[model samples]
Structures are given as structure tokens and as C-alpha cells.
Target chain A: AQSVTQPDIHITVSEGASLELRCNYSYGATPYLFWYVQSPGQGLQLLLKYFSGDTLVQGIKGFEAEFKRSQSSFNLRKPSVHWSDAAEYFCAVGAGPTGKLIFGQGTTLQVKP
Target chain B: IAGITQAPTSQILAAGRRMTLRCTQDMRHNAMYWYRQDLGLGLRLIHYSNTAGTTGKGEVPDGYSVSRANTDDFPLTLASAVPSQTSVYFCASSVGSSGANVLTFGAGSRLTVL
Candidate 1:
């Protein structure tokens, strides 16, 4: 079965520091990977997606993700973390032809002043 | 706005009661879905509709049901609410049922069954 795994449940980073959130997926074929962010009391927003071509995909709010086919991972990275970047991040893999997504347990990022 | 809208931002219900979570999308997307979010469980798909008049069961669909009478509406119904059904329900839609389509999510409805 197709599935996604986000290793870190919670992560804290100092403002302006570099950040990386790890994600790994298990799928039978070429995977469609995505990263989504959810603010408190709000719906999820798409950050980035990797369907094909270009391993490094950039997204909104200065977020980027690299899809490593060999490792079956698509980890999100940010060069400088901001206070507003504190939110729950989810890694998901698009499954089948229905566009259904299999999401991993989210990683909560907390920015420290 | 041209996005998904979910009704009953939050609701408290007693076990054995019936409840419906309404979802409407003005985007006129071809695919709509319902998912339940829980701590440590991520989000599990409850049900999905590929198009009008067709529905499919998802990862978790034992106690829940759905009907898609039209392209814009997909309401999830709980035949008999249970304590385990307490969750934050999210309704999402995509332009199509292809892997390349990105899903747009609603603000979500927090449901509590006591």
C-alpha cells in the first residue's frame, strides 16, 4: 500500500535558522509527492508538489522541497525560518487515479525567539 | 470566494445520533473527498466522489456514508455517531481525479461525539 512517513513529530528552530523536515514515502510506482502547511484553526495550504521533472520544487511562503527518487523521500527545506513559519507540516503521496492522498503524521514546527 | 466551503464549523453530538457534514465547492471541481484528521494518525480518507452520481469508499469508511448528487456538493453522513467518530473533518476538491491535480481544502468542521 502507498503511504507517507514524516519522521519528526515536533521540531523547534530559532528564527532565521535553516530548517529541514524529513519525509519518506512508499509507493509502487513513480510517486506524486506534496507538502502542505496548516496554521492553527485554519485549513491546509499547498506548499509544493513534485510530480515529475525537476527534483527541486519551490513553493509559496519561501518553502522548497527536493524529491529524491532513489531514497523515496521528498523533504521540505527553508533557508531562513520566520515566526510566521510555525505551523504543522504534512507530507503526502498522491495515490491511484482518484487523486486521493495518503498523508503522514504531521510534523509541528515551533519557532523560538 | 471560489473555494471549498464546509458547514457547521463545529458540532457536538451524542452517540447514536445522525449527523451530516455538508461540503460545497464553487470551483466546480470534478473530484471531492472527505477526510478525518486525528492526532498521530494524520488524515485518513473517509469517502470520495469522482463525479456526480458516483461514490467510493476510502481508507476509513466503515461508519460513514456519502452522496454526490451534483458536481459541487458532497455531504458525508454518519448513520450512527460514535465516540470514536470525534474528529476534525476536512472537505477537499480537485480539478480532476488525476495524480497531478492539487486539492483545495476547506476550513474544516470539528465534530465531537460524546
Candidate 2:
């Protein structure tokens, strides 16, 4: 079974500072990877997804992730983060063409002023 | 129009009681999914339907049942609610079975089993 791992339990970054959230996955074949964000009491919103193509995938809210096959990692990055970007972020893994996603525990982001 | 609406946005039920969490989508999507979110555990799929009348078990299907009578509705039911079942439930839908299928999620249904 495919699984995702998010090493960070919590992250705190100052406003306008660059940020990176780490994610790793275990899959045999080409895996479908995704990043989702959830606000308090709300469902998850997709940040981005990577299937099979360019290693780097861009997403909304100025977020992006790069898929590294060698390291089995798909780390999310942003040049600058705003206070509004503070939320619980999750990394998901799915089998190719199945449309089924399995998510990691999650990493909560805190924006410091 | 409500993109996806879940009935009884929040519910508090006693242990051993039976409850159903309703989900409906108006986008005419071909696939619908049910997932539960718990603190420290991101999101786990409870059930999924490829289309109307076809349902599949996800990672955690214990104590949960689902039915898909039409293209728009995929409701999840629990025969006996337990404290372990207390969590926020989310309903999502996607277009096809492609690798890049992006899911559109509902606001969520919060359930607290006392």
C-alpha cells in the first residue's frame, strides 16, 4: 500500500519569510502525490498535485512542490508566506489512475508576526 | 447552488446510537468519496463510489456503511456510534479515474459521540 509521511508536527515562520514543508512517500510504481490545506472547522482544499511529468508542480496560494524520485520525497515550498497561510497542511499519496488518496498525519503551520 | 451540502452540519449523539451522515453533490461528478479527519491523523478514507450504484471500501471501513443510490448522493451510516467515531467527516467528488483527478470537498459534518 502507498503511504505518506510528514516529518514536521508543527512549524512557525514569520510573515514574508520563505517556508518549506517536507513530505515523503513509499510506493512501488509511479505514485500520485498531492498537498492539501485545511482551515479550522473546514474541509481540506487541494494545494497541488503531481502525476507524471515535470518534477516541479505549482499550486495555489503561492505554494509549490517538487517530486524527487531518488529520495522518495515531494517537498512543498513557498518563496514567502502570509499570515493567512497558517493552517494544517497534509501530504497525500495515491496509486496512479485510481483517484484514491491516503494522507499523512499532518503538519500545522503557525505564522508569527 | 450549494456545491456540496452535508446534512446536519454538526451532531452530538450518545454511544451505541445509530446515525447517518448525509452527503450530496450537484456537480454530477462520476466519483464520490467519504473521509474522516481526526487530530494527529490527517484523513482516512472510509468509503468511496466510482459512480452511482458502485461502492468500495477504503482504508478504514469498520463500523461504517455507505450507499449510493444515485449520482448525487453518497450517505454514510454507522450502526452503533462509539467515542472512537467522533470526528469530522468530509465528502468529496471528482470527475474521472485519471491520475490527476482533483477532488472537490464539502464543508464537512462534525459529529461528537458522547
Candidate 3:
């Protein structure tokens, strides 16, 4: 079974500071990676996804993630996070055509002014 | 565009009562899925339907039942609701089986079993 791990439970950062949310996965074969963001009382929105090709992938809202096969990591990063960017972030890995996605515990991002 | 619509955005059901969470998608996607989200745990798949007629069990399917009569609808039901079933449920859909099958999610249906 494929699984995702998000080490950080909560993250607090200043309004203009750079941010990174760590994610690790355990899969036997090439994994399909993705990052999603959810605001309070809302469904998740896809931030980005990595299928193949380049290791680094850019997504909406100035977010990016890099897939490292060697370390089995796909970490989400932002150059400067805004107050509006504060939300819960999730890392997920897809499993074939079943359309099943294994997600991480999630990280609550707090943007401080 | 109404990507996905889930009825009774929020609900409160008594224990042992029957409840059905409705999910409808306008995308006419080939695959639809149901997932429950808890406080500590990420979204866990409850059930999934590859197309209109084929349904499959997900990670947590013991307490839930689903039916896919057509392409647009995938309803999840609980014959006897329990306290442990209280959680926010989300409905998602995708085009088909692929490497980068991105899923579009519904607003979510929050159910509380009292």
C-alpha cells in the first residue's frame, strides 16, 4: 500500500517569509504525487501534481514542489507566503486507475503579520 | 460551472438512524469517489466507481455503502449511523485512469452523528 507522511503538524511563518512543507512517500513503483490546499470549511484544491518528466513542478498560487525519487520526497515550497495563503495543506499519492489517493496527515499553515 | 454538488451541506443524525449523502458531478467524469476527512487523519476513501456501473471499495468501506446507477451520481449511505461515522465527507471525480489523474472535489458534506 502506498502512504504519505507529513512531519509538520503546524507551521507558523511571517507574511513575507519563504515557506516549505515537507512530504515523504512510501511506494514501490513510480508514484504520482500531488499537493492540495484547503481553506476553513471547504474542499481541497489542487496546488500541483507530479506525474513524470522534470522533478520540479509549479502550481497555482505561486506554489511549487519537487519530486526526489532517491529520497522518496515531494516537498511543497513557496517563495513568499501571503496571509491569504494560510490554510491546511495535504500531500497525496495516486494509485493507478483505481482513482484512490493516499494523503498525508496534513500541515496547518499560519501566516503571521 | 458546477463541477460537483453535494446536498445537505451539513447534517446531524441520531445514532442508529439511516443517512445518505448525495453527490452529483457535472463534469460527466468517468470516475467518482467518496472520501471522509477527520481531524487528525487525512481523507480516507470510502468507495469509488470507475464508471457508471462499476463500483469498488476503498480503504474504509466497512461502514458505508454506495451505488452508481448513472454517470453523474454516486450516493453514499449508512444503514445504521454511529458516532464514529461523524466526519466531513468529500466527493471527487476524474477523467479516467492515467498517471496524472487530477480529481476535482465537491464542497463537502459535514455529517454529525449524535
Model 2: CA > 4 A from native: none
lDDT per residue as tens, model 1, B20-86: 9999999989999999999999999999998999999999999999999999999999999999999
Interface RMSD of the candidates, in order: 0.6, 1.5, 1.3
State the lDDT at B80 in candidate 2.
Answer: 98
Cand. 1 Cα-lDDT = 0.95
Q: Which numbered prediction scores highest in DockQ against the true structure?
A: 1
* lDDT of each residue in A24-52, candidate 2, tens digit only: 99999888899999998788899999988
> 1 or 2: which has the higher lDDT?
1
TM-score of each: 0.99, 0.96, 0.98
User: Which scores greater on TM-score, model 1 or model 2?
Assistant: 1
Question: What's the CA RMSD of model 1 in angstroms?
Answer: 0.6
lDDT of each: 0.95, 0.91, 0.93
**Candidate 2 DockQ, CA atoms:** 0.70
- Comparing candidate 1 with candidate 2, which one achieves the higher DockQ? 1
TM-score of chain B of each: 0.98, 0.96, 0.97
Q: Write the per-residue lDDT of candidate 1 for residues A14-66, one digit (tens) a residue.
A: 99999999999999999999999999998899999999899999999999999
lDDT of 3 at B17: 98
TM-score attained by model 3? 0.98
Clashing pairs in 2: none
Off by over 4 Å in 3: none
Top candidate on lDDT is 1
